[model samples]
Target: MNTAHSLAPSQVSNKARVLLPGARLGLLGGGQLGRMTALAARAMGYRIWTLDPQPDCPCAQVADHQLQASFADDAAARELARACDVVAYEFENVDLRLAQTIEQHGYLPQGSHLLAVTQQRLREKHAVAAAGVPVTAFRAVRTRRDLAAALAELGLPCVLKTTRGGYDGKGQWLLRSTADAARVPDAVFHGDAAVEPAGESDTALEAPLVAEAFVPFVAEVSVVVARTAQGDVVSFPPAENVHQDGILRFSIVPARLPQEVLRRAQKAAERVAVALDAVGLLAVEMFVTADGRVWFNELAPRPHNSGHYTQDACSTSQFEQFVRALCGLRLASPRLLSPVVMANILGEHLPAVMRHLPAWPGDAKLHLYGKAEAKPGRKMGHVNVLAPRLEEALELLRTLQVWGPLDLPAPRLSS
Candidate 1:
């Protein structure tokens, strides 16, 4: 028996299940991703329920029922699985053991193993490399001695990241020289911090670390792929990503790269989805070097920020595609309907964004996640600008003063 085949839904004694409209879909997270997914599921005639510590989480605003509990609470996780026909998760940092417990209660199409592999930096890199994808040089750092050895091997300007529980530029420290190493704790490098209640422990949480050699890349791009239990797969057009201080700030769809390069990225993403037997949306991020080499950067096994452009550019958005895949419906076309650029609205931009909201061009669409408070670096929402040509859309995005500036200009779009 092939292990890969066994991992899929077919191996289960129970036959493949299709969740029709009006079924209660359970989500493990209630952030913006869950909110958008819930909205899509509701439009397709499905009732949505979610488990989130915050009763008024973004998803709670749209879901039929909200189980107010921590993600690590096994009892709440089990209750959520029991209440819904099938279970899915928006975020990847969910407790691995809790997900396994939920699996015992009901359907979790994406599976717990995929979650386990993605939640840790070291595991994700190893998994991607095993799939025959190229990745940057990296080493697991578990002690001060290990960090010293890794730095000696990988060199200065390396990035030390927690093995688990970090996102949006958090839980990362850049060591540019020997002086920077002093700031990182010896215990942090060793993953010796005790796990605390509510998943909070130390100033820099105790978790294994991975020190990676930073690559000088010309562009960052991502491919979003949707896969189903039946092995059907479809990929959205690649998106060129721009980041500020490690946080994604903008994404340009139909990334201005050679057709051959785009094809390579797409194919690699499809291979990754198959290797993981991923059952929903999987976003594979890659780096394109100045020499035209593409290297795997990371993975998000759910609707990604880069794919947010699909909401206005494609016939089927990534969020809706996630819903379709979760419900066992046939995957829809991810073909681009128009050239577009999407800008993430950080908390700092909220005031300006609201002031200029009514003045935005008719082709520009703004989506605001209903977060109660706006803090610096928090993803409040986003704006998608559409046009007949990629350059036109990018030009419109560049002109949006509300976003401050397009700091890293796209070489192809820059005049």
Candidate 2:
């Protein structure tokens, strides 16, 4: 049996009615992504019900109803399903059992199949490759011997990552040599990424670690694509991304790449969504190599950090598209309104951002998540600077010096 196959879209959407205004959107997880999506839903006159452990979570702040309960609480999960018309996910780390329960009790348009595959690196990779998208060569390592064998097969300078939950580079380590491999704890092979997850249950210890060949990527880009249950699809322009200390810091729109490469990135993203038979948003991250090939990196089946620019620069925000996809509505145009530079406001940069708030540029749009605490490396908010030209926007960010300069100027955009 093909492990990557998707249930037919017709089966998923046949019973779907156009969720009119006043519909209750059940949001799973309540980070900034949830908050933003909730805001979009409200703009369309839809009420939101958010389930998260934090009573004052960012999403809950805007949602019409807040269910402050643990994600593991089956009772609360059922309650959220029964109380809302459509339930959707905000992040990718949702428990499969929780999603399954929601699907059984509520209308989860995007089923748990993608979650089951994407929960683990091994399965996500298999699904992406099976979809005919190119990905870095990888091997599954469940034991120390598997690690050694995978290293031998892929060679040094690879990446060793836990198959389970980790974001912002938590579960991944760049293995430059055998010494690096030796540094990874044996527990990692057993499903603990050694990155110290908050709880044992947070780790998907049943799955193995994935040892992936490190690609010498020239640039990293992501495309946010949406598909409706009725088979409609649309992709936003690719955003060039830069990561610092394993966390994303910047996403530049109209990625300064060859036109062909940009098109390839969107096509690859659309391919993944079609192959997955996705019914909502899917963010496909890819690497543009020196050879001009765009290789699949990973995926997020919800709104992505890289697509944040769409909130300010596109004709339709990704959050709105996400809402549309969930309700089986016709997708709005994803036309680029301007070249934009989206810089993340890490906790370290929050003070400076606050200091300059009054002086923030007219062309810049600020979005801050209502988190009560701040620490180094935590994503506090983001600023999207728009301009007629990409260079002007990037230069504006440099002048602010809030986070320093763009990692690398897009050669063509600079010219």
| Winning model by TM-score | 2
Clashes of 1: 0
* TM value for model 2: 0.93
lDDT of 1 by residue, 93-177 (tens): 7777777877899998887877877777776787788899899999887777788888999998998888777788777888998
- lDDT of all predictions, in order shown? 0.84, 0.84
Candidate 2 lDDT trough over 10 residues, lowest sum: 194-203
Give a tens-digit lDDT track for model 2, residues 1-415: 0012234555444645589889999999998999999999999999999999997999999998899987777888899999999999888787677888898999998878777766667778878999899999988777777888889999888998887787899888899988888898777776655222222243333355888999888899999988888767888999999887789989998888988889888888888888887778999999988878899989888999999999999999999999998987888889899999999998999988888888878898999999888898999999999999988898888877687654665533212
Q: Please tell me which predicted candidate would have the highest lDDT against the true structure.
A: 2
- Please report how far candidate 2 places residue 359 from its true position, in Å: 1.0
C-alpha lDDT of residue 333 in model 1: 83
Pairs that clash in candidate 2: none
TM-score of each: 0.92, 0.93
